[model samples]
Target: MQQSIMSTLPLLLLLLFSSLFPAPSHAWGIHGHLIVCQIAQGRLSDAAAAAVRGLLPSYAGGNLSSLCSWADGVKLRYPWSAPLHYIDTPDHLCSYTYDRDCKDEDSFRGRCVAGAINNYTSQLLTYDATSPSTQYNLTQALLFLAHFVGDIHQPLHVGFTSDKGGNTIDVHWYTRKTVLHHVWDDNIIKTAENDYYGEGVAEFVDALMQNITGEWSQRVPGWEECSKNQTTCPDTYASESIAAACDWAYKDVTEDSLLEDAYFGSRLPVVNLRLAQGGVRLAATLNRIFS
Candidate 1:
């Protein structure tokens, strides 16, 4: 009995320490959201640029990318915003129908990520810098749209209902005890930025922009599908993520899965496309709103 108590003491202490310290809560990881925001900033129209300049001076220097992670930073104070990060679908069905899914009990009249995107977007359309309340709403709305766009693109954010979007399924990247969601959220992007684009974040963003060739860089007009009365459009984006999550993110994944080069190599293109689409679509949304 003494030996048993002694054996468990270390684990008890470890649990206490871990609970006190706690790992950082990352949404789309910092650099992931930054990359998407940077791309959108690069693609913003002149009107959109002017609007961003006026609304976001509270950031480090009015840089649009500065506010990209604002929603994550505030998630603690506003617990309600947490569900804005992901949309859940039923297990193994491998498809998204927003009407059937996307609604959670905690949601405000069934507001999920897609619904949040649409709701906030309409607020941006009537942005008023003069009124303090309007200014505050505008800031929050912009932050939500920026973060949600990146979030929805992450395949796992539109993931299975069973695993809390892969958060419950344990896995590891090399030696780190993480889960499948973190692999999609941080590991892959971290690997790409650190290993492939070793020149640091700014350089990496520049390279990513320069690498955007073929149809990836092409601008699409009227690309804000969530504008006005339309709800199905954002669902389409969620559907794309759900499909990718089922077909790719869940492939061969298990609790003991060890992620490495092969995993990153196969999924890098998907990551890039998601980022590109997110950036372009974000620019499209801003263009329409601030036009």
Candidate 2:
């Protein structure tokens, strides 16, 4: 009886911990991460694709999208990484600077989403097929880089500190009581999938792919380019996010504001554009890293 009681203690502690600190809401949700990674995998160069396939475990079947949300799932095990998913800027400032705003709640510098991108990009850069051992886990690094790239593009991920990037703001998403951050992360994308794509994520991806090759074709080159030929340009992406947050996301939004068709219709385009950019940029970064 003593042994059996001891054996169950770990499980009981886990349950208590979960109840005390529930999993924080993930940025972009699972489908959003899937959409970004799927688009990215489709755009990888031959060399990048080969490297990605070699790094991925057998269960993944060489599909990076299959594990795009792996980082979010491991948050409990990697408690320190929670801060790496978003940057909280000064309320109403509507601007982001790495030095000033990139710290976590503990004020540790270079600990935000943009910094995570740079850190993981550097880790993946050390990948070498010739080396039998590496100091870093390139597989985890690749996964982190891919996910952070997607996170930085979500406007509210770079949102105001006072509101915890809209996570604290109580709002009704078309009669459903939810936070504003979730409205962007999952609700909007889910609604788009349901209403326009017949609830098919693949169909939604198809439409974005078409737009990328069609209406947004010319902008693709610019999106994929990092200034000064850097491997990744997350700072630029974060800057764009805060601007979008101010101009679109936080605009006309307040505590308990009901958001419906008018809000959805106008903001869906921004969400789509950001997702497209995240995919394009992830591919570009991987191509540079593997090249």
Instruction: Report lDDT (CA) for all predictions.
Output: 0.75, 0.89
Worst 10 residues of 2 by lDDT: 3-12
Residues 50-79 of candidate 2: C-alpha lDDT, one tens digit per residue: 889877764567799987877776679788
User: Best candidate, TM-score-wise?
Assistant: 2
Q: Candidate 1, residues 1-291: lDDT per residue as tens digits? A: 574355445434544553555435546887888988998998888888888776653333556676676677665556787777888888999998867887875545446888888878877878764544423357667778988988888899888888988989988787788889988888888888888778377776776677664454454433445545452257778888988988788888888888777777888888877777777677777877887
lDDT of 2: 0.89
Q: Can you give the lDDT of residue 47 in candidate 2?
A: 90
